[model samples]
Target chain A: MKISEIARLVDANIYCKGNEDTDIRCAFACDMMSDVLAYVKNQAILVTGLVNPQVIRTAEMMDIPCVIIVRGKEPTPLMLEIAADRGITVMNTKLRMYSVCGILYNHGLPADEGE
Target chain B: MGALHLEYTVAPDDFSRAGEVSGIVKRTLKDLGFPPAVVRRTAIAMYEAEINMVIHANGGKITADITPEEIMIVFADQGPGIPDIDLAMQEGWSTASEDIRDMGFGAGMGLPNIQKSTDYMDVQTTVGVGTTITIKIFVTQ
Candidate 1:
């Protein structure tokens, strides 16, 4: 799905417009940056409630195109700056982490391909 | 022969700037047209070590030497060094504060992750003086 479609699907606000036309294949919903770093699932979108530089760091290292901050958490100025510099999309939504993950998963953004 | 040389100074206090160096290194590898697996390994190993430096040692300096055959990363810090390198290398032992843990780090996986991602990793640390970690990821040429 295009990052724009994800924002529309989840009612998210795009904090940074970058690579919006990139199609995301899968998603990962986790607040633990370690897990995100360790698990190489070819996930394209990272949905987490944690707002910090590490989130963007993980995204950049993994080449993830989009980051969704759930529960209306605001991205700090540094986070936005880093995201902008790296050309990674950032979005915020009012829905909680689990709910947002569920909605996106239901809409065909599976967290992983299979067991 | 060394192909590309890079150096970055990690700030001690700013958690926001933790991955700046690793990001640059990753981009450099990408621009050099390294294979995806080799680039990913180098990025992951360097990133984990960078996080460890930020959380455990306050800050440090990272030096990366990239060659066609291997990428070597040296992370040196002057904070209170790891008390027990063996224990610290374990999978679940962590001395990180609650705040660090809350940020989704300090799971005692940094060293192991670095080891896993790279072809080889070595740690040299002194309790009061400082610590320096050297990690190498070899790419099939």
Candidate 2:
């Protein structure tokens, strides 16, 4: 799914648009940066509720191009700055983490089964 | 390609700038034309160690030596060292405070994640002195 499509589906607002047309096939939802670092494989979208600069840092480390902030949480300015600098798209959604994952899953976005 | 060396100092408890060194290293690897997998692995491994340095060790120094065959990274700190390496290496074992946990880290997966991401890992520590971690990720053509 393209990042723009996911934004539409989840009613999210793109805070920093790095690449709206980037296509992603998988998603990993986790607030713990360590789990994301340990498990995420392949280029996928990151769905997280944690609002901090580390979220952006984790995405940059994993080469994750997009991060969806759930539960209407706002990202810090440093987070947006890093996201913009790293060419990572940052989005905010009022939907909870579970709902965002379910919506994406229903739309054929498979979970990133880090293997 | 000729060997390249880089170094950076991490400020203690600087959560805001934790991944700066890893970010630079990741970009360097990418610029050197490393495979995406290799670059990602190196970045993840180094980033985990960098975070540990800030969270546990009050900050440290990270040095990266990059060669065509592999990238070697060293993280050295003078903070409270691990008393039990085996227990520290275990997943879901952490001594981070509640504040750290609220920051979305301290899940006790840092060391394990580093092990999973790199090709080789070596840890040296003293109970009250300090700790140093060295990791190498081979470049596969």
Candidate 3:
């Protein structure tokens, strides 16, 4: 699925549009950075409610291309700056994490099965 | 190609600047034409160690020796060292406080994740003194 389509489906406001046309292969939703690092195996879109710089850091480490902040939580300015610097797209939605994940899953975005 | 050595200083509990080193290393690996898998593995392993230094120790020093064959990284910190390596290595045993958990880490998966990401890992520690973790990932051409 293209990143823009996912954003449209979730009604997300993309703060840092890093390759909006890029295709998303899978999605992983979690508030725990460690779980994302331990479980995510491919380049995927990260859906979470966590609003910290570590979220961006974890995505950079895991090569996650996009992060969707759910529950209307806004990312810190530092997080947005880092996301922009890393060329990782950052978005936010008023919907909760579960709803965002469900919407994306319903749109045919698969979950990342860890290796 | 000659080996490239890089060093970074991690500020204690500085959550905002935690992943800078890993980002630089990742960019360097990409510039050097390493495979994506190799670069990601090296980045993830080193990033976890860097976070550990900031969270557990009061920050530390990170050194990376990158060559065409492999990348070796060492994280040395002078904080309260791990008392039990076995217990600390467990997946669900974490000593991080709730504040750390609110930041989306502290799940006790740091060491195990590092182990899984790297080809080799070594831990050296002394309680109340410090800890040093060394990890290496080979670049397959």
Candidate 4:
């Protein structure tokens, strides 16, 4: 599925327009940035409740095209700006982390290398 | 072709500017047409190392040598060095402050993550003097 589709599916508000058409495969969900860093495997979409610049940095480092901030956490202006500059899509959803991950999984979105 | 060399200085105490080097390096590697997996791994490893430099060592310099066969990244910092590398290498042993943890890091996984995401990792440190890390990730044909 494309990032735009994920945004709509989760009722997320996209803060950036990164590759809306980019194909998204598995999703990695974590608030622990290091864990996210340790386990991310070509997952294009990152679902996190953490709202911070490092979140953007992690997504950028992993070449993740999109980030969906769960739990309705608002990202700082700097974070949004950075994501926009990097051409990475950012979105916020009311769904808590577990429900967010579960919904995506139920929709056939694999988790981390699809294992 | 000689490996494309890149270098960056990570300023100490600058949490906001962390990962700048890794971001640029990632872009350069992608633009060079490296395999996506190779590019991703290199970016992740280097980025984690970069963050570690800023958060732990107050800042450092990163040198990356990108070759067709492999990419080598060396991170050197002049700060309180690791006292016990073995303990530091553990997956969940981090000394980062509570503030850092709130920002989503400091989970004692920086070194481990760098090690796991890279093909090879080497660490050299001297307490109160500094520490240096060398990581290599190969791009197989």
C-alpha DockQ for predicted model 1:
0.75
Off by over 4 Å in 4: A113-115
Better of 1 and 3 by lDDT: 3
- Per-model TM values vs. the true structure: 0.93, 0.97, 0.98, 0.93
Q: What is the lDDT of residue B138 in candidate 1?
A: 80
Estimate every model's Cα lDDT from 0 to 1: 0.87, 0.92, 0.91, 0.87
Cα deviation of A52, candidate 2, in Å: 0.5
Q: Relative to the unseen true structure, what is the Cα RMSD of model 4?
A: 1.7
TM-score of chain A considered alone, across all candidate predictions: 0.94, 0.97, 0.97, 0.94
Model 1 TM-score, 2 decimals: 0.93
**Most accurate candidate by DockQ:** 3
Most lDDT-accurate candidate:
2
Q: In model 1, what are the clashing residue pairs, if there are any?
A: none
lDDT tens readout by residue for model 1, A1-115: 8888899999999999787779888988888888788775584699999998889999999888899999999998988898999899999999998888888889988775422
Record all residue pairs in model 4 with backbone atoms less than 3 Å apart, i.e. clashing: B12-B58, B93-B108, B94-B108
B22: Cα error in model 1, Å = 0.8
Better of 3 and 4 by lDDT: 3
Ten residues in a row with the worst lDDT in model 1 chain B? B1-10
Evaluate fnat for each of the predicted models and list the values in order. Answer: 0.70, 0.85, 0.89, 0.85
DockQ of each two-chain model: 0.75, 0.87, 0.89, 0.80
Model 3 interface DockQ: 0.89
Model 1: CA > 4 A from native: A113-115
